[model samples]
Target chain A: MASKPPVTPAFSLAIDAMGGDAAPEVVLDGLELAAERHPEGRFLLLGDEARVGAALARRKRAARICSVRHAPDTIPGDMKPTAALRIRGSSMRLAIDAVAAGEAAGVVSAGNTGALMALAKIVLKTLPELDRPALAAIGPSARGDVVMLDLGANVQCDARNLVEFAVMGDAFARAVLGLTTPSIGLLNVGSEELKGDDRVRAAAETLRDSHLGANFRGFIEGHDITAGTVDVVVTDGFTGNVALKTGEGALKLMRDLLRQVFTSSVPARLGYLLARPALDRLREWMDPRRYNGAILIGLRGVVVKSHGGTDALGFAHAVDVAMDMVTHGFNESIRDGMAKLATQSRALPV
Target chain B: MASKPPVTPAFSLAIDAMGGDAAPEVVLDGLELAAERHPEGRFLLLGDEARVGAALARRKRAARICSVRHAPDTIPGDMKPTAALRIRGSSMRLAIDAVAAGEAAGVVSAGNTGALMALAKIVLKTLPELDRPALAAIGPSARGDVVMLDLGANVQCDARNLVEFAVMGDAFARAVLGLTTPSIGLLNVGSEELKGDDRVRAAAETLRDSHLGANFRGFIEGHDITAGTVDVVVTDGFTGNVALKTGEGALKLMRDLLRQVFTSSVPARLGYLLARPALDRLREWMDPRRYNGAILIGLRGVVVKSHGGTDALGFAHAVDVAMDMVTHGFNESIRDGMAKLATQSRALPV
Candidate 1:
């Protein structure tokens, strides 16, 4: 194994080079791309040193900013998170260790989400105000980019957890999305005051009375997500995960149906040729690659999880997400928000 | 008020004419369309006598097989279900009363959902096995029409309730969707066995061992709903409602985005004209009107609730749904399935 990582640049991020479906090469390519955009973003590439170093040698830009670190093993996607904890030499574990050792500002991986979360919690711990960290991601909405959280992190959540997610999502929107005072909405079955269980209602009441109440939109239904009724849509992980996947499925269905229609006849094919440019515009606007990262919020350090199926550009976006959080001191913002709310009154509803 | 209803035909349905946004007119129009489809179908319209009678006079097809019943009151869309229950003479209540009194084989309404369910429970009653009725609806999937249940009917479902919903959904798919032995799945965050709550796991276990085991597909994710991974998707009403609405919202967004693309440029508009036929075909295939009814299963009679914003065609489809269930003895089938399950050890997990 190579020697341990040396002192790192301020915004350096640890890359789990052997994590994704197309590992090492895609990770290096993504880092090169990220290096172009974020000149100040340095990387500690953690993987099988021989393969990762060879790949890093080919990508001049990435090599210039990245230091190769030897990780003896790779975490398999199907392995249980608890079991993976014992595999300390794995690329994912090494990246997380870098963050814990203060060699990296944050860590990014497209590895097993469960393993990443479990490892990050143990190594980095959580922000003091958080009971559990939330899985937050940015997706396209009619108005603009909207942030959603708890996308399958904590299966069951109480009022305090929900309120915490709202706070984190709110802070994320302002930090990454550059919103002045981003509004937030709690996802419910219906917007009616009487709808949803006691947990949601209680969370709403707490948010409503707090200082964030000025930007709090009461309750939004699932449809409000794409309708862009609010900036940050917060919910328990169970529903949030289902809702996110459901949205993806619907979009996929539409895309398939549209493709079938376009190829149905010669005239339709011709129509597609003519409409290609505008359709391409639509495709670009809704590209999933542009929103590749799903971050674990309420963590002491930025922790971004890229989708396993993503390509170089998508992985680059995940790196961008981590760097954005690191540079903006996002955890500080969340802490500040919680501290202010606590001073005003107890953050939890009585 | 008029006299009591006369003896009705075998497949007679009571119409809540004052229930929908379009009122007695759209209800009568839908009946006229439904009459053309089912010459054997008869209706007893409940609303203000003069208004309903006047509307009936204009629709020759509907009038020939229908009779008017006077119900002077109307239930508001936002009225609480409990409050609506006290208004006995409201058209929704009258239609439910007609079902309870054996004046009609089923009932169709586009009224307040909460009120309809509450009133129907009081009047028509739930079948013996059900703790609460589940809402079932058909929607377009890649393979074909897929039946999903518990769509905002019973928010919190126990293991027993989920098992009941699976049985009811099985009966519904066979009788209404016309599948010989429809496959079923329990919706969860992930398809893994350990993905969902205890209730879903228990229900899966029960289904796996029961007679329905052959057709059960274990756990499925939310994306499976539109992917047509199974013929029936079973979930608690809260998640189902959110998933259903999320799908709707995604489709709406795609529709809007397509429209914008089509109108964005001259070449695009010309391309749209050329592609109009195929696009229309796609629209027809995925038409919401084609899947119009959400039925309250586990009830004594077939009770269909139409979307309030639907047109005459959509309303007619809702009637068609009700009549299909009535003719197929869907409720009887549900009872049979439950009875069979009861005979094979207790349905709930030990």
Candidate 2:
């Protein structure tokens, strides 16, 4: 509700082309697809120019709206965040720097998550009222799409940090999911108010008493994540990270089991052939590529991290998330919401 | 490895009949099924005589082995542990007391989990070396089955607590799953040693140096839960609870989506008919009844908690878990393992 209209004109996004498993190839392919989807959008591609140029030349749509900016190095997948901070010319750093320098409205990368988070936090910095940024990602639920935050950024979070996450997650859902007023729930072991640890209980108290209380749905269990019990699910990094990965693992297990079942007997294989179209639709609906982007919320500029192992389609989905944030003036809304929360907290009794 | 042959022969198990959603009927049905499977076993059925007698009248096998103990009250599912503790004659308390008095080798209850854990801890007490008890449960995995601990027992755990969990989990895997030596892993966000909090890192260090180090597999991610990367998963109650429920949520989502897909078209329905046998096998393999019990580990007596919402088959599975623990001398193995760990820890440098 606090969101304001976009003050700035349409802006270009920067891409870290030399990141992810497929590097320049997948990045270029994703860019081409994104370009066709958003014809008015422009991209500043950061990587080795020779390789990026060659990849771009093959894609007419991407070549029309994308410009290459060469970078000499890339942040390795296993590099420590502290070690990654010193690498100035790395593609991840350069793409982030583009946002800082006003050349790009946001940055998208299928790269080393820790390194990317470290670089983005340093380059773009947190919003004025927020202490730290959170990683928010969309997950497919039975009812619809659900947004969850603090995915692995701050492993140990306090009450205040959780409150901040709830605020950010609410804004994220509205911006990315196109919701007018997203309902929010704090992820807990049980739905009862007295279920979790001190930090979670305190956070729930604050949310219940805050300006966003109307949209707050109190405590929700882990099953609520996929059940779509609420539009936004807020949690500490440790629990969020584990819950997200656990869901992914379960999905993979079921998929593998389904494949084994279908291939086990001749009749089953024949049935698979007849059901291929419907099954394909189901697979597409549940595809990880559709929800590849993990957004770093509560930051001054938009930053979307794609899964490092994702293909072109997944990478393009990450780009789409960044585009949504930029187009919706997501940062401005977060800043306004944070300012209101600060004032409201100060006015309340200790 | 420290497990010994059962010294106590042919002991009866106490069942809390006045619990769960289906109450006396499901409990009676489950007892009948369990009685048929283990005809040598006897049961001390705890509930109101009128209700228990009426339910048992229709059953032949269970009526032969079960003797009813009149329990005037039942712990309501919504009652807190502290409140439930005051009600002495409740069915849950009486069942646990049966184990403490040595009338029963173990207790199985589809009742209030918090109350069961509380009463079991207060009545039966923890093993000498264990500070607190943990809730361990079997979950279906890709390879076979996996054991995860502290499902909802200890909300916060220290390094020593986690190490104790690893020890208890190892013993649990051995006794319940019939494994000689089960591989153990600490559940974390990443498999790397440096990825977790200080407590987790400290636990890993301790497990690696302890006598149980032979079975220690270092750190494992949340995905490993369903992947069956380790025989036992060690985690604090908070993360464990969230991960377990999230996995369940994902599975339910996939099942619902599949059902929707198959029912959308006439050809899909026909394909479903052709694939019915294979799909039935898959469903059977993933059935919740097969993995119904959550065991309270590190206690002096074996205590199994069935899902309150589960039907007769699920309750029977819970009884089976209790039988396995009782027959294998689970408490004795845990005691022996803990004694070894205590000796090993003292010899090392602080």
Candidate 3:
């Protein structure tokens, strides 16, 4: 007799259907494409059931796939993260509750970043001892994507925050990149131990004293973000936000400049003709979607934030990312690791 | 009879011969080109007599066109601004002192920024009623170059620092861009009045209450830096430096990405070929050298900071910028206007 095939447990994503500037349209499109790619991946769209159903019906996808869980209100995009949490009917809250109730393996949103973080903290909660949650984004580097964290998730931070981010960022690197002991760094204005503000100086001292799973590679600078300087670069949210947006604005400006340069004169245009092969190799490497989704780590279950300006293709990419986190058991691994570390010391913030 | 052409006072520029990474060579090159550009322009190269003489002979220029003023010690680039000020023999001191003594109309440097500011403060001093000096740079924008400050001159700032930057930056915009009244906007994380930290909020209130020459346009964001959303964007030096560099780095990356995109496929390369004309216009507009010089505003005399990594061409542009400021009496106009304001309010920082 043939051996019985083992059953693979099904995992579902609680997608905040009302979130995102494009709303149900982009979300529905992303969901359908993701379902096509991962036949086993399922979604529970959380929003007004009637509206979500109607939107899905228009795409003719309602009958084939997807289910709706009604959420009455939503956190406004402009509302403060702290204020948004008090609103109980907010869709972010409902989505987090779904994960906590075991209805979904993870949650995803491109909505109010602060609200998602707050709701994640309230419902999903951090590991029993974890003090804060960090938003980690994977960036396109020379080697591949590098996971960078606290990309504007926290306003103020201490030495402990840096150490925690390092720990969390390491788990992210390992799960996403399959690197056992990824090299980690504390992002600073300079690579020297004596560089940057006092907070960073304190963090550097703390990182040196701790024994993180990843290798601590001193400090990293602005250019290092793109040069593939480390597997993980940790910083407080303020600087991270500045770095991320700076990169975005720069990429946009450069794209415009190149088009102008290539088409400006006949000889330069001809020179571009000769340089065409090299340029193509670079585009595939810098595609924004390839680095779109950012995981809100330290939550009880997986949660991802897609860029607000992403197109259908980008949204699809983020969905595939959400599915990968669930399948790889990234959260469980992080929890177990932290639990182990917690036993070793009681000084951790969590 | 010929009305004697108003006896054009001998135009003098005190070159900080020991300022940049490449120092005397680039300074001499800049002075030579500047002298060539304006037959009336005379250079007072401040450095050791031997080095200046060697550099001048190498250029094969007539020594009569330039004069040398001896100063022994050089300010090391990495020294603290305050400490550098206390050291008496520093070349920066002697060079700035020349400007104060009416031997030179302006001073230019590519060396120790902090030392330059400190010595410039001690020698040239701030305009009457002015508190701290600001390093102002012209950012490339869609409308034209926008005057921004403090471009990394001071890190910690209060509302008064921002107000002074606005006042100085407005004067610059008028002097260079020929605007009767430039629009001034505080660079905040957002446009809303209450969007920024305590300092920003207080500054917004102060700006709304104060009277500056430029038309105050409220707030602008990082994206606005490139979009030319406002004529003058005021922030503390720290954020300004990060924003400016971020924009620069992003432009380079995008240029790289565009080259890759156009060359990757045959059709895209053809598109690039078709789009060649537009690209060149963009590159010429965004060239760093075109906007290379930064004015150290609020000083009693004109002081321009040329890019540390400047080449011969860039150095020439800095010289041109200094020439315009001197010809237009840029510093005096600001000193006069600010002095007028000083009589009315004794509480203002500057």
TM-score of every candidate relative to the true structure: 0.96, 0.95, 0.82
TM-score rank order? 1, 2, 3
| Residue A223 accuracy (lDDT) in model 1 | 95
lDDT of 2 by residue, A1-350 (tens): 11224335335688999989988999988988899888989899999989999999999999999999899998999899999999999999999988887778899998898899988888888877787899989999988899998888988888889988988987888788999889999988888888889888888888888889999999998899999999999999988999999999999999999999899899898888888889999999988899999898877678999988998889889999999888887887787787788777543212
Q: Is the docking of candidate 2 incorrect, acceptable, medium or high quality?
A: high
True contacts kept of each: 0.71, 0.75, 0.24
Model 1, position B220: C-alpha lDDT score: 91
Q: Residue-wise lDDT of candidate 1 within B113-164, one digit each (tens)?
A: 8899899888888876667899999998889999998888877778888888
Residue B1's lDDT within candidate 3 is 5
In the predicted model 2, the residue pairs found to clash are: none
Worst 10 residues of 3 chain A by lDDT: A1-10
Q: Rank the candidates by lDDT, best first.
A: 1, 2, 3
Give one digit per residue, the lDDT tens place, for model 3 in B1-350: 00122233343677888788888888788777776777777877778789988888877453557877788888888888888887676567777877877767788888787678777877887766567888888867766778888876775577778877877887888887677778888876557775666776666665655566337888777777667778888987756765666566566555666666766777666766665566656766777888889888887678987887787778878877777777777876676656655554344542
Off-target runs (Cα >4 Å) in candidate 3 are A1-11, A50-65, A72-92, A112-118, A121-131, A260-284, A329-350, B1-11, B21-23, B57-65, B72-93, B100-102, B112-131, B256-281, B327-350
Which scores greater on DockQ, model 1 or model 3?
A: 1
Assess the local accuracy of residue B243 in candidate 1 as a C-alpha lDDT between 0 and 100: 90
* lDDT score for candidate 3 against the true structure: 0.73
